[model samples]
Target: MTSALRVLLLCHSFNSLTQRLYVELRALGHTLSVELDIAERVTEDAIELFQPQLVIAPFLKRRIPESVWSRLPCLVVHPGPPGDRGPSALDWAVLDERADWGVTVLQANAEFDAGPIWDHDLVAMRPASKGSLYRREVAEAAVQAVLRAVARLAEGGAIAPVAAAATAQTWRPSMPQSARCISWQRDDTARVLAKLRSADGQPGVADNLFGHACHLSDGHAASAALLVTLPPGAPGELLARRDGALLRRTVDGAVWIGQARAASACGEGKPFKLPAALAFAAEAQRLPELPASLERPDDEWGELRYRESGPPGARLGCLSFDFHNGAMSTGQCEQLLAALREVKRRDTQVLMLLGGDDFFSNGIHLNCIEAAAYRTGDSAADESWRNINAMDDVALELIMTTDRLTVAVLRGNAGAGGAFLALAADEVWAHRGVVLNAHYKNMGNLYGSEYWTYLLPRRLGSDDARALMQRRLPLGATEAKRIGLIDRCVDAETGAKAADFESGAIANGLALALSHNLAQRIAAKHQARAADEACRPLAAYRQDELSRMHRNFYGFDPSYHVARYHFVHKLPQAWTPRHLAVHRERGTAA
Candidate 1:
């Protein structure tokens, strides 16, 4: 291994990719600091302050300052292969249905993405949304390429570019709404899905419903079972609603548009992405309602799902909750709790909680909570209170399930309240590529609830738990396993279905069925729960946490509200938080 070097990360946001790289680089013993891409001068200031040996722009929205990069070695992570030069590299790849995609670590120079490639990984593409593609393949590739580039930089060597890509370049412009536009009357299911999936996360495809304009996102190809039930209307007309998504007929079949934003939110008001049903509640109410049970077909799309396998004596119940972007609202929490309670009463010996592949859960739905302020009688505070309480209730149910071995299977990422909720399980099984943001204070000093006060202390002792909570750092799966934050971190797996909660549990369902002392272990689990409950009622821990959260919600200080607004509206960062911008730390040598 090469020696560690001082590195600075400049990104548009501390997104999943950035956080993953942060944890990875830190684990490798590199001295790292982060600076948000606020402006060119801010970039220059950070460079001067840190005086870093190298800089990595994992996810920048704009060009880096030439002044700094010309003087310092900077590597830009492009979510595309060598020779690809554009803002919408991944977007164009998805839209054009490329067989393979890649992540390139290139030297930052005069011409963007035309720099010498330090390393790159070209892999087969999966049929997924832009967001899913970014989180999974794009992220993993970038990590590998970036690690290699950094190691090469540490060891004395001459960097070079691949001859094929350096000889020529393909420059694609940023995809616009016009390019992503769907001609419902002409486009078939395949064409429609490609368009929607290409722009799933940002600058969603412009469309209309109920004679009102809206932007479509988080789409799923309608399964045969669902399509058979839906009665087709006009090509563009919505035929049914289920699980907060609206089912609309395409030229040939239908697709489930999970989330949307109202056109009215575009011009004067800030647009919020929400469940399609909620976005057009009045219009959606008039549509045909599609009912789906937990035991529905695996191919069907829904927010929650459940299945039972294995023998009667040692049955395994697998439950999945695939909330959009893993942001669980109050309704989603309640539904999940209901499912958990139902499965708890079953004769299963193990319950696997398989969260979505893109994101396990980031916590409560900030966009939905922000939307509450626009409703006639709803307040954001009330919605927040309801969402957190519902989350707490779900955590309580998991904590109380002692008869079965509960495992939180994290295929993607988990953060905030969701991170603690995973701790509610008997064990947390994480994918090797998974990232966990195990703190809540980053969100404008939120005193999070979700039973973290009780859960965190048990795994990590009181002092360690308190320190972890205040750290506000994202933990890699390996680091978390080393620190005992997670039970197991397994190798990465192949691609899973998108938006459909259809992936199986990871790490062989944590070998729950094969344990030699399964019964005794369960008995011990019961005893441990009983002991903890007797010492301090679970309700007390909840009350204390919620009491602090109450101050964040209904209290005089509006930090939480301000943070939520900026987050939901995708506002530009005024300044990097002191926690991440560590160059601002005192007593630093010049």
Candidate 2:
């Protein structure tokens, strides 16, 4: 028989799940305290009042303070597995078309969901509604897992933490309103549906029809036909109704919507009713489409331009490394490497610039992996091994080289290789809102760029680094700065401050020359020796761990199983043989 345990339920909104939890706990004769609208400091008060042995934070949007979490034992019920920790976990998993998914019950540490795992329940989900999957499947799984976890704690048995499988995968936060907008011109029906599903249960997808706000939903999506009027004076000015299917247009000579909502309102709440017409508003104005004749030679490096204002000679050559539109390609890496070498030889300073307002890079493109996997389908292990090797080569070169002073100036979010790129830099300057993380581990491949094991420990202490690597920590700028991972936090700006290095003034020029002279002297006497000796081994050890991590997490490609555990079963899967092996190795090695 189990003794009644005191459990406090923390949530933002009291949903059906919360009500069920309350009832279940009562039936078990365990005392329960409910706290809703629990944000920041309020959480501390709730904790004090409850003084419960176990805390179950479910659907709580606000981050709990470290002080509150440290006071007592607590567990967080995450919708995804340990590796799949993040907001919008379910939405991301569904859009990715993962075969399996699960929930995790983790120790409540200062870090978000990056705590050690107690247990998890796995679930398999079909291609279904996101709301149905979460409310019906995931919620039930979460309840069962919580009960099991509580039972384990009551028994006074040691809780085992499952290390997340390794891969250089990342989690993207919910896309902003602008990024989530539907681009009718560029998107196909399938793409549009994906976007609609992604933004479902949130603000629906917005479309701009000459400056009108037209929101579309799958609610009325089953209609077979639509009629749309082209902009005034444009080609195909006549309005006509046609089948509302994705098809190739005879006049346009491209894939186009067969039917669309007409400009004129047919009726209130009707399918053909014209949403308020408005001009197209994008986060960024679209660049003019390039002409086919303007293609650069394949062998030539693309010229990249950026601004660096300060005293004369004070501005360093900025690399502005970006992998937008897709993952970093081999050719792109090769071109970037050459650019870095050229900048080094020129004795210019370098700052890697990440393009796009949101992402620095998405890491190795999945398309590339899929293509390689298909080509070498007969030898899956060899294909994956080769892929990991190639990725490591590029990542290691970036981390080890770069003769000039390298600074990763992060103005936006960075993940996977983006995070690795920042870690490789001598110093990282992040904006207030930036997010940095080792997202690759969430994917099935653990052999992320070799720098994580070494740099992570150096930036955050060994204990924290271990937690981050295994638990997959996502640090905001302030948290990152507090842990010494980010050197300084600055606001986005146009002009320079006194403390900032300037580009053209006489005083700044002299300062740059003096700084350069000092840097050269340091390199000759200390920096070079330190790099080859201390840094190299540290980096190598990290790489070694990463290789092991890949074998442990993705060696057998358990992602499908892991995903099934979350989505369909809505229950946590037990540690696999591979996971146990890795855990034992770490234990014995330690």
Candidate 3:
């Protein structure tokens, strides 16, 4: 057993990786507090007040001040192999096509990522983008490395230092746009993909499309039909368009560019990343539009797709909505609602909602709503209202379904209204490593309404439900299970490495389990729905919630707009929020 220790979590942002570490450490009975990397004085003040026994910087953009590190041990999590030292470690790893990579937990020294290593773990690299790999493989390795380091610290022992040698570590600078630029005229499909993949989530590859210079992202190798329809265009020329992307012919093949961000004469602005079609509307409309086929192809890329499997009566229909970064626009919500209704019309015993690999959903798309303020000459408030209502429509569809038992299988982190959306299902299951931000207060005290006023109370009484909505913190899958937030947490056993929940193992396990007692589960679902309707109608719950939401969307207050603008623009933090910077709270510091 490990003794409880006060651990101060110092990070740049409470991102996915930091949230995972926060949840895991709290589960181990560690008293944890958070302090963003704001400034040296603020960090020093936190250290003096919290007086934590140990400090862990899960993610940091700047170096820890000497005043604090000299006082306490500060462990920095670096996404690189043991001997790799740099800021752009993952970027280089993906661009270089390394077969294996790892994460290192090292003590913060005068030099960055050069401190004595407490522990490190190697993870086989996946052919994924920097953001995807960071969320999955790098994150898993970091957890293992951090846990090993913490356990060693708990038990008083001499930790082995990483051996130093000449040319042991390599330092790589931040990748510039020039380095990420793709050459459609010269580069093959694989080379172009590597460049674009390295810069997927942020700082997309700078390139030209339709006589305009813009950054490209969300790339996919063309499907069979798309490949055949490439109208013999010259290299580097835009061939066709579909949905929100434009297809460009490469030296060997073609790639669909799903998103882009065009620079304007007004200098750098908030609309840095938008759907390719939306950003270049006129140009996109000129190209031939090829609608995605309803028939699922062997190899194709799309935001939504459906697949049916299982033998005879045990037939299962799985609908996956893999939205980029799990953000759903107003149109996306309507499209997915239609897709959900279509899948329900099919002949299947059970229906499973398989969300994206990295995120189940983070609620309505903030970026799209923010973009509407400028792109479509609409008020941000108007767009937000439409988006939230569309989200409610999708949730309502899930709530009213009675034919087949609906199961929400969360394989990734979910937040805000997304958590409540999952609750719309008959049964909600999640992978072990998943973290759920169940509260909406973090986004400027926005009172969320996705039929949550009803769905949440049904699971955890009235007062507990109210308290949960107010507690603005990330909940791990295990803790969420105990609090009755989810029906089941599959493979949530504690161990070293983070759970490989991204793999289809949990979904397969669920399919097998449901197959055994299909009739009873379906019957139980029906009876529960009937009983719930008798108690109180779902429409009443939606009305009550939407009434409060109306005040939020079209009220005198503009807190949501201010907060949403700051978030969508990637504004720098003025001061860390009191909830996260717990060390400053008079009596809250551990």
Candidate 4:
């Protein structure tokens, strides 16, 4: 048994959980201090006054300053699980209709909510009122988890942090009011319901038809009310009224009013009725076209919205490639290359957006590759060499030659050529649930792309990259990051957590690691040249092997085998030197 502990509680609002913890700590004969409205910065007064050996921040909106944290042991009670660190965690989970949720206690770091977790307690929810669930169930779970964490800390026992993989499949931020705006033209009833639920009980879900203003309310489970002005020549618009509900017709769909308030003559009294003449005039005023319902087109996977508060030109330029339908055609490739070259001339930083939602790409179109090979009527070795070389050129142009910083944001499944495209970027940011595969080897083709020969080795080491190619491995986002294939992993579906990618964290981290005092010395000598040359032989070897593989695999339908291999093998193998050395030598230093 351990002695009682000193605890400090930081919170914006005093809730039942905070009260419970206060009582529990006191009952245990522990010292407890409470602070309210703490900002990100820590004041010396606070440190001196509390002088806590262990600091516990529960329901605190502000980030703890390094000054305070560096001095003593501090733990944050996050409302969500390891990867679920962010504001609005509960709201998002409910809106997404997730089956499970949890709370985590982590060592606080400069980076918000990303610290290695100490312990967590999972919370299971049934279909109940969102407000009640949050206030009751979530609060209880949080307090209990915190108490356990404190006990563990006192005993000096290690608490294993849950791996990101242990969590659910999707993530998203708390729904913003903008997300709730209903577009009559683009959205269906189901989508509308989702949006409403996302912002359910929030201030903006329902709005006045005339001014388009939403009602302001507290919490997310409260009833919503709205006001509307009817159009002229709208018959019996008040034909139906039940309770406070009002029914009206629009140019398109029939509008159902769940609840409404009619403005008084002076707009100052209760049970007020809008003057008939004024209501007519307000409706007649020329209003801009009402937006269509919010329906996403079939082609759109998803979109990422970003706000930058940096200097002018600080925002990176975006270079987008749509592999949505399929791989780029020769013509498309040529056009893309030309555009990239032009962007380079302008010195613009570029971020490539591949297919939205679930795919950066599926890789080279099988039909295109097969046609080219058949037309040549060449030996397996000859056709493979040509195809690999072509792919290599495309990859190299994007990865090596571009002057501006390049990043690839992948939200979906990427395979073969798609994987290479991501690797080519200066940094790769992927959602946590993304699937990445190197399907080339199984397709009877070696991994033929360019800088991948160099980049893969730099990231995963030559041995690992070789194994991956040889075995045609497919990886989850976490595995990809672990092997250095991708720079960072995030939950793509929810966009909730601040994954390492949001602020160019990956690029910055890599730059720190790679940028060395010896870099200047190495650049001055022929060491860089030597390393490049040493790798050349390996590239040539791989190219040749890849070509032969493609020839052998062609006409057999690579997809079936690739899929079978991934499902059956569980893990991909590494490529052999015997295969890779052949192609590296063919493309010389020119």
Backbone clashes in each candidate structure, one number apiece? 0, 52, 0, 41
Summarize candidate 4's per-residue lDDT along 1-590 as a digit string, tens digits. Answer: 66677676665544334644665565567776555533444233444655666777776766778887777767788777667766677766655567788888777778677666666877776443344345445655676677777887667664333332234323454557675665545554334434444443333254444453333111111111212333443421332322122333433323333322233212332221121222222342333222111122322211222212222343344444543223443433554555565555642333344343325665554423322332335433343344445555566566554334566777455777667767777678776545667546645444455445666777788898888887543466666787778888764331222233333543443343344442343243335435665757546644664554554545455653343233222222232122212222232211
What is the lDDT of every predicted structure here?
0.85, 0.50, 0.80, 0.50
For model 1, residues 1-590, the per-residue Cα lDDT tens digits are 47778899999999989998999899999999999999898888888788889999999887888998789778899999888899999999989888898888888888878888788987569878998888877888889889988888777565443332466689999998888899999999988989999998898889887887888888888888777766547898888898899998888889999989884533356677888898888888998877678888867877888887776677788898888899999999998999899888888788999887677888999988988888778889999999999999999999999887898888779999999999999999786778899999878799998899888988899999999999898899998999899998776542433222234353255356656788998999999999988999999999999999999999999999999999988999999998898987732524
True lDDT of residue 74, candidate 1? 86
- lDDT score, candidate 1: 0.85
Candidate 4 has its poorest 10 consecutive residues by lDDT at 216-225
CA deviation > 4 Å runs, candidate 2 = 1-313, 325-335, 371-387, 444-447, 491-531, 534-539, 549-554, 560-590
User: 1 or 4, which is superior by TM-score?
Assistant: 1
Model 3 agreement with the true structure over 14-116: per-residue lDDT tens digits: 8999999999999988888899888899899888889898899999998999998888888899998877888888888888889998888888889978888
TM-score of each: 0.96, 0.43, 0.94, 0.37
Candidate 3 Cα outliers beyond 4 Å, as residue runs: 158-167, 264-269, 375-377, 492-517, 587-589
Please give the TM-score that candidate 3 achieves against the real structure.
0.94
Evaluate model 3: give its lDDT: 0.80
**Which numbered prediction scores highest in lDDT against the true structure?**
1
lDDT of 2 at 467: 75
**By the lDDT metric, which is better: model 1 or model 2?**
1
- Report the number of the highest-TM-score candidate: 1
